[model samples]
Target: MATLQQTEHNKTVDAKNFSRRAALGGLLFPAVGLFLGGCTRGLTTAAAPKVAIPEGRGAFALRADGTRAFRNHELVDQNGVKVRFQDDLVEGKVFGATFQYAKCEGICSDMTQQMKKSYQLMKPIMGKPVNFYMFSLAGDSPAEMKAFMQAHGIDNLPSWRFFTGSSEAIADIRWAFGFGDPNEETDKNLAGHTGMVRFCNHKLDKWAACPAQGSPESTARLVVRLFPSNERPQLAGIASKIATPSYPMKNWSPAKPLTANLASQL
Candidate 1:
């Protein structure tokens, strides 16, 4: 009976010890959690030191160039060469840009054909550097873009390039160039895409666009006029031969002057 009583007493003491340890552990965990929480809060609230990204290499490099609003997203060409959008492509060159997808069944082909025709027209009369960029909206791989170029029967030219990149990058370029529709839903629907060709002379700070579905001749003229007067004297002489309509033509709106500042409104 004495031994039995001693064992019971020991069991009670052990139970009390276990309860105390568990309670202490519970309190200790909260204290540790609070310390970690404080440390995390301090780290998050601290200002990150600025690091200089050489030649605009980082994620936020696009915002560094103040002259233009477009991001300098990375893009790969049909030939598998990587280039920066605003820096390598559009810096001082007069370039025309179009958005497309490799498998698009709609007006994408027509748009490309129009650009081809315009290139033929402008190449012979141009004395300045010019380029044409066909940016893919579907974010295809470089090989896929090359295959798409081949399937279209379009030969890659030194001055003309086809590009595919991340969808986010492409979206930034697309909306930046004013290719999206005013209606949000329509803009999201790739089928209802706005088939417009955007032209920019980064040096002159001039930008313009003409309907790709419209006459290629007009598109050619619109692009040629973007060049300086001395460089495109041939085009300058014939500038009076045609003009944008005083009123809206076809299903499109009339021509309006565009400036770099208007990118914010897009």
Candidate 2:
């Protein structure tokens, strides 16, 4: 009887010990796995460093709504002064840009004339100073750009400036301004260059474009809207009082969506 009781007691002790160990292991194993997994994740994170800005594309320091990038290439102004394109002319400024050569007798002339009218309309109501830039697609010298401006009767406009650079640089700049055709062959045709006017409020990163061939009033309205509401009271009030004119739709077509690359850049 004593042997039997002792054996039974030993079996109970053994069962209790095994149960305790099993319960302890069940609680500890999950915690150990979680700790090990966390260590592995930390090591992986430490191995691959994060980059703040993308490589080779930080020239613009773009924001979520940033329209596009610009080159800081050296450019010559109409006054024969060398200036950095973004730093000297565009940074923290509200401006309009047009592209043309010194010798174009077609749409370039019309575009310049339209821009002159637009500026005149924008001047009276603008509370703050704004600028206009004309980049030469033909890489015209400062003197040539001055001559072109003089012939257009816009050389005396204080807020306007003309710029020129090497042909290669100008080519790159044009695309930066979102003024290129996807079709390489079409883009190479200089005579068929874009007639759109690019508008930017660099400080706000707001960008817009309008057809240079459009009515001066239309273009002026669009550009004026880029200015701060407080700075455009006169123009904004005038616009509010005027009614939108009706246009004939005989030849009108619905606007198509921009190409993917162009859309992404802008």
Q: Which pairs clash in the backbone of model 2? A: none
Report the lDDT tens digits of candidate 2 across residue range 119-202. 777775432546788888877888999999999998887768788887656765665565644344565677788898877666
Residue 97 C-alpha lDDT in model 1: 81
The runs of at least 3 residues in candidate 1 whose Cα sits more than 4 Å from the true structure, single-residue gaps closed, are 1-66, 125-128, 181-184, 233-266
CA lDDT, every prediction?
Answer: 0.59, 0.62
For model 1, the run of ten residues with the poorest summed lDDT? 32-41
What's the lDDT for candidate 1? 0.59
* Candidate 1 residue 82 C-alpha distance from true site, Å: 0.4
Q: What is the overall TM-score of model 2 with all chains considered together? A: 0.64
